[model samples]
Target: MNLARRALLEAGKLLVVLWLVSVLVFLALRLTPGDPAVLLLGPQAGRPDAAETLAQLRIEMGLDQPWIVQYGIWLGAMLTGDFGESARSGVSVTTLIVDALPPTLWLIALAVVISVPVSILAGTWAAYRGRGWFPNMVRFTSTMGVAIPAVWLGLVLIIVFAVNLSWFPSGGYVAPTEDPVGFLRHMVLPVATLSVFLSGILTRFVFAEATDVFRQDYMRTALAMGLPTRRRVFAYAARNAVLPMITIVGVQIGALIGGAVLVEAVFGLGGLGQLLLSSVLNRDYLVVQSAVLLTTVAVLLIGYVADIVYRLVDPRIAR
Candidate 1:
């Protein structure tokens, strides 16, 4: 298909996926045990008029409405950029999300900046070395890196670098505008923790792709021609190998948003992940639903961009 047609089809798929996600996010919370109305009126639940008050609150909050009606109301509000109020804090859900989004974005951006080059270099080096000890070691390390949990890694780094060494703070976030140096220092460990896992996966992927590129007939011909090592690798192998890595990297970056949630919680960054967790625990239905839907939108957009990048890398994909 042509690019326009492909894009249209992708857009349709995006809408379908988003609709499904909206339905699931709505139903899942409603099906859960706790009533948001009851949760909100905590101390008042013991009052003599508790039942009467709860019933009145439910009506006001639209909790007394049928599931379909509630879903329709929410979906309509969301389409117009109104995410409603938090059931717990009575704050606007959109405002809550907007406030929390930046720290998470910074974490993901920094992690990508640190991890990508390291992964590319390590992976390319391993591929170039073939079956040598270095390649074997890279493979082993990458495997372990992927298997390690982000939360555990964050804690270990904190104990070593933050506590014993006193090199970086244990947990917290500082906006770069307020204190550039302090912000960098605060982020180092969390960024490092996130980078390690991201690099591990990317390294393995690049190694596999570059290895296949190295084995291609053209690469063998370049070898026979005694082409300069840099030219052969960069001009021939890398160009081809990097094409596939683009899509994987894009998807991983999208996933990194979700993955950063655990790291953010561990490090106390007050990012969307932490907000979402708190909202879920507090039964802040609007906040939780909006957070999840926002995350889903981010992931889908990243994937769509990756598809576009594929067409840019190799125009054949658009066909």
Candidate 2:
């Protein structure tokens, strides 16, 4: 019952957040300098008929209405699965998002797969090995991970792996459907770029939590009871350490989305981040709004799943 109530509350909160995000996205675009109408009309913007053209464009795009009315119209159409047309391309905004989503999703998935296990093992080893060169190395790596900018790291990797060694493609993504081997080859550099940074952050979280868990009375009791060293450490200490890690993972979801923007730019991947960047630059309001909302929805869904995962990991959380 408590879990159900919590889920209900979370759902309600998510809805409220999404609504607020939509409002903010609308206003942010509208409040920015430069008129979308003027940008749309381009070279004709300074002609004798420019004002008339702008007025017609505003009316056609429903931008002549009050902000509230415009938002209402947008929200209503969005509810019906209409994200509106792209101001720049005349293409459907939804179609653009759909096309760009896959590469970003794949990049994120690869990052998680590589980062989580590597961090957990490295952190656990550092915690158990107790005051040694290995632990110092782990700590140093984590510090550097936090310090280095992802874009700089990405550029360096491209220089070494792609430019110098020719071990992987420099940039640009290949669809897995087109050629599986080529897809993996293309993904290697970007995925590794994302994983290294995320793993560095995750390592610190895991090490801290595992160290704390190792100090707890339950872990001490397990040790005293002569439970096999590995079993006791993992089954008891590691399981407890996971609760905090779940929260870290949830937070990382947002970071991954943001990081993907830079990573995509570096690698020339045609993902949602790239699309969002271009749309925002072009002042394509519909595409920008749709992309941001879609990304936010993805973040919220990950958070909701994290909540459920927390309950599963420790049933006491459900209470």
Candidate 3:
């Protein structure tokens, strides 16, 4: 298939996945035990007219409507970019999400920037070493990196770096505009925590790819031709190995968004993960639904982009 046709097909898949996600998120929240109206009117529930107030509030919030009707109303509003207001704070869900999104984006962007090159270099070096102590150590470290919990890693970093050495702050976010140095300091541990996890995962894949590339006939020919060590390993071998790594990186980015929840919580960053968690706990249905749907859209789009890049890099993929 041509690029245009492939893109159109991928776009269709994205739409279908998003629709399914919307349905699942909507139903899942409603199926949960607590009633939003009751949660919203917690203290007032003991009043004599509490039942009457709850009934009125439910009607106003459209909770009295059938599931299909509620879904229809929400879908319609969503199409027009109206995510509705939060049940607890009465703030626009869109506004709340927009506010929380930047910190998470910064965390992900920084982690990617730091991790990708580091992983590629480490993996290529490991593969080049070819069964030495260094390669064995890299493999062992990657395994432990993948096995370690991000939350636990975050706490350990806090104790060693933040508490003991006083090199970085333990938690809380500061906007770069307010104080760039402080912002970097606050983010160092969280970013490092996320970067370590992602690097661990990416390095393994890179090592596998690079190892295969090194074994290729062309790579052997380059070595026989007395190609410079750097040029042979990087320009020839690493370049070929990195094409498949694009898709791997894209998938990791999506996973990174989810993983940020734990890292953000540990560090107290007011990111989307924290917002989604709080909304769910408070039974803020609209916020929860919108956050989940938005996150699904991001992940699906990232995967779609990765597929496109993969096809572009190796046109034979379209076959």
Q: Per-prediction RMSD in angstroms?
A: 1.2, 1.6, 1.1
Across 1-319, the per-residue lDDT of candidate 2 in tens digits comes to 7788888999999999999999999999999998888889999999987898899998988889999999999999889998989989899898899999989999999999999988888888788776999999999998798778889999999999999999999999889999999999999988988887899999998889889888888888888888998886677766677676886788789999999999999999999999999988889988999899889998998988887888877777777
lDDT of candidate 3? Answer: 0.91
lDDT measured at residue 198 in model 1 versus the true structure, 0 to 100: 88
On residues 146-219, what C-alpha lDDT tens digit does candidate 3 reach at each position? 88999999999999999999999999999999999999999999999999889899899989999999999999
Compute the lDDT of residue 122 as modeled in candidate 3.
90
lDDT of each: 0.89, 0.89, 0.91
* Candidate 2 segments exceeding 4 Å error: none
The better candidate by lDDT, 2 or 3, is 3
Per-residue lDDT of 13 in model 2:
96
Which RMSD does model 1 reach against the true structure? 1.2
Clashes of each: 0, 0, 0
Pairs that collide, model 2 = none
Top candidate (TM-score)? 3
Tell me which of candidates 1 and 3 scores higher on lDDT.
3
